[model samples]
Target chain A: MDAKETVMNVLKDITGTDLSDKMDENLFETGLIDSMATVELLLNLQDELGIDVPISEFDRQEWDTPNKIINKVESM
Target chain B: MVNIQPYGTPEYFALIILFLLPIIIGLFNGRRFVNYETLFSLVFLVLTFGGSKWQQGVALIGYVIFEVITVGVYARYRAKQNNTAPFVWAVIIAIIPLVIVKVTPAIEGGKQSLIGFLGISYLTFKSVQMIMEMRDGSIKEFHPLAFIRFILFFPTISSGPIDRYRRFHKDYVQIPDKDRYLKMVDKAVFYIFQGFLYKFVLGYLFGKLLLPIVAHQAMLQRSAFFHTGLSLPLLGYMYTYSMYLFFDFAGYSLFAVAISYLMGIETPMNFNKPFASHNIKDFWNRWHMTLSFWFRDFIFMRFTFFIMKHRWIKNRIRVSQLAYLVNFLVMGFWHGVTWFYIVYGLFHAAAMIINDIWLRFKKKHKGIPHNRFTEGFAIFLTFNVICFSFLIFSGFLNTLWFK
Candidate 1:
């Protein structure tokens, strides 16, 4: 799946609740992700996308959304 | 102080590794499911109650003895009392040890060893909850091994999620299948390692790096902004608290949960999406839910029941209001005997009650009155309320405020 699809899918899976729009930023505030769920998300990305996410890359900005996480993973 | 410190040094590591000697034998013996908890407790006994310093060993021995006798007797006695008062009695009796430990001045006259309170605090809470349940007839037969394991689970021996007895009993008997145990182990390994990163790496590193600056600034009182700015930046440190607490406690809880799972038991979920909470009420509902549930069951219910029976007052404030007051104060006091803790709990109780009222009002009024301004304000208010509560609960701030 592409970045957008990946983002939407991960958010839906993690939150188990649909969101209003594209998963860009503020996933934490919007209740789409949390600390534990973020770890889960990281694991999912690693398992699914064949990307190694450095622990340092898991700041609020980076892990806030699938697009951001995807971009970070791709950059890595 | 019992001369044994919580911070494990080289000697501690050596002792711990050495303590594992028996388990190593158990390991070689094809230990077909050795309860690591029982072994750890024995190790702890060897280290704390049966080790080098006679005084230390005596203290631990005394501690274990007291727990076995008072809490032990209470557990058995409450199993027949068949009422709510036994729950109260157990809690009171449980906290007595904590209070004694906390109030007793260290022989060294230093603050380092708040011996017995933290671990035993957790121990007693679990024990008390168990006894009350047995009394209430919630648990029919108790496994002595599982009970010991539940009490002395080493990972959470430091901090805890305030696990209750009913959950423990339920989980212990319903042991997971082998495949599930392996899966839990995988998750446990991840959590334990991840928790180390969060607590030791992210938290301790930041504290070591910036603590000097923060302490120095606090001491100098350089300027108004200096303190707030230092503290704010050190929100990274505090964020580590949020981070550390979640990972550390969650990891530890997962450790116990996974281990318990191996032996076949499903403990209550200690955490869900806590920070994902939309409101303060939502936050409590998600965070430290075991403790919240216990307080509701043991404290809140009793207080409300008492008030209702007496018809304490007319519908002016509601029995629920009084219940919150007592329940939260009990919660705060459970943390410590300090005034700040008391106030902290009271604040939360009021906030929760008000939030409930607001929710009720909103529901009664009907329709989602979506106002961007109101929603933003609500978020800001909720966050500030939480922050201020933390400020009150804060270690340094509480001392400073008291001073």
Candidate 2:
């Protein structure tokens, strides 16, 4: 699977909500995840997808949605 | 004495109503009359600071001048260049007064600091936040008058539902339409009544009446010990102190917010059914929300960034765990440099860490039924844990431990 799919799967597992069609929707804005869950998703991305996102660069506006998370991760 | 402390009694409400009536009438007629609002703010500020507590008044003036200059100078410097060293120094100097205030009592056998004033912590929160936002280029302009108005906004100066600089500025400059102003009036009236019920009635019952009774009883039985060395009346004191703490602080917060709404500023709410929290992390989000958010934004987020940028730790979990410890430890120290307060902070830090572990465990073990009963049980557990922490925070333990 691609990094995006991997990150999405991990997010779904972390938040226990499906986001297949809501890829572009903001995770926090849409209430799909919270701060703790955000930390979990970061760790999951690092462990499962080998994308070690520095928390410093993780602005909610920029990496808010699944697609945004995927884009940021793939770029890294 | 003709001096009055702000919101100290119901009598003060009459004066507030008398002064604000004109401003309200002007707003309804589509005129803001900023001068009236400014004048009333100064008058109320004087009432709060100009009484027997005039020393605090001097400290407040000196403190505001220092912060205004520090933030103004820093913003100007940031506008010219982006350098870490000077920004760091500016931030440190801004916080020096508060640090002295917090530390002095601990070291000097509980004597208050000379520079200490009421609401120093809240104002410091606002100032430090402004400096950080300026460094981030979020606060682009720093007008001296607007900055002063933002910091000295009277309703919340004593305690806060701490408003943001930009948010306060926007609200300050705009004249809410008649319809919106009326709606604000409705909410303001309701919140003021609620504040009376919360602060005057329930807060009096719990804090003024029952807390002292239970506390006295608890002091008498400090000798009893269980296997964990816990005592009986101490248990009673736990629930009593927790209720008193909530009612008193929540009442003050309600009054503050209600008055802000009266003045047409949408100051945020501080408590939202915090006892209903299912976990320690959720509790923090609900309780003293603005203060916690301030800490989260300034201390937790910045510490996380600093840690990650320096690569001080390789493991993300360890990095966050350490951040939580440092964040809460500073918060505890800020409350006062005492053992119980420090332990209270450490307890919450540990509770949140354990809560994370439990969440991870729950995620792995699907059989651990995700149902109402479990959720209710979680809430129950969290409530008691928090109450016990409040018991420690009440300094009854200090009476039991050392006295």
Q: Candidate 1 chain B — worst ten consecutive residues by lDDT sum?
A: B1-10
Residues B1-403, candidate 2, lDDT per residue (tens digit)? 3578667789888889889898888877878788888899888888878878889889999999999999999988999998999889999999999999999988999999989988999999999988888877778899999999999999899889898888788887887888998999998899888888888888889888988887887777756665233766678878978988898889889888888877778898999999999888889989999999888877887776667656788676787788889999998998999999999999888987898778768766978887899889999999999998898788877877687
Interface C-alpha root-mean-square deviation of candidate 1: 18.9
Q: Which candidate is the best by DockQ?
A: 2
Per residue, candidate 1 scores C-alpha lDDT tens digits across B1-403 of 2445332333553555455555434433434245664666665655443434555455544655565565566656655655666656766776676766655543445343434533666776776666655554555566565666667655345456566555555555444455665575466446545545644565455455555455454534423463443445345334433444455455455444433333344455677766655578667767777777667656665455445445565452465677778888878877766767788899999998897677656745768586977777776677667756765665555433334
Note the Cα lDDT for every prediction shown. 0.58, 0.84
Segments of candidate 1 deviating more than 4 angstroms:
A1-76, B1-37, B48-57, B71-91, B105-118, B140-146, B170-174, B222-269, B313-317, B371-380, B398-403
Pairs of colliding residues, candidate 2 = none
In candidate 1, position A15 carries an lDDT of 66
Q: List the DockQ of the predictions in order.
A: 0.02, 0.16
Flag clash pairs in model 1: B171-B265, B175-B264, B175-B265, B176-B264
CAPRI grade, predicted model 1: incorrect
Candidate 2, superposed: residue stretches over 4 Å from native = A1-18, A21-32, A36-76, B226-229
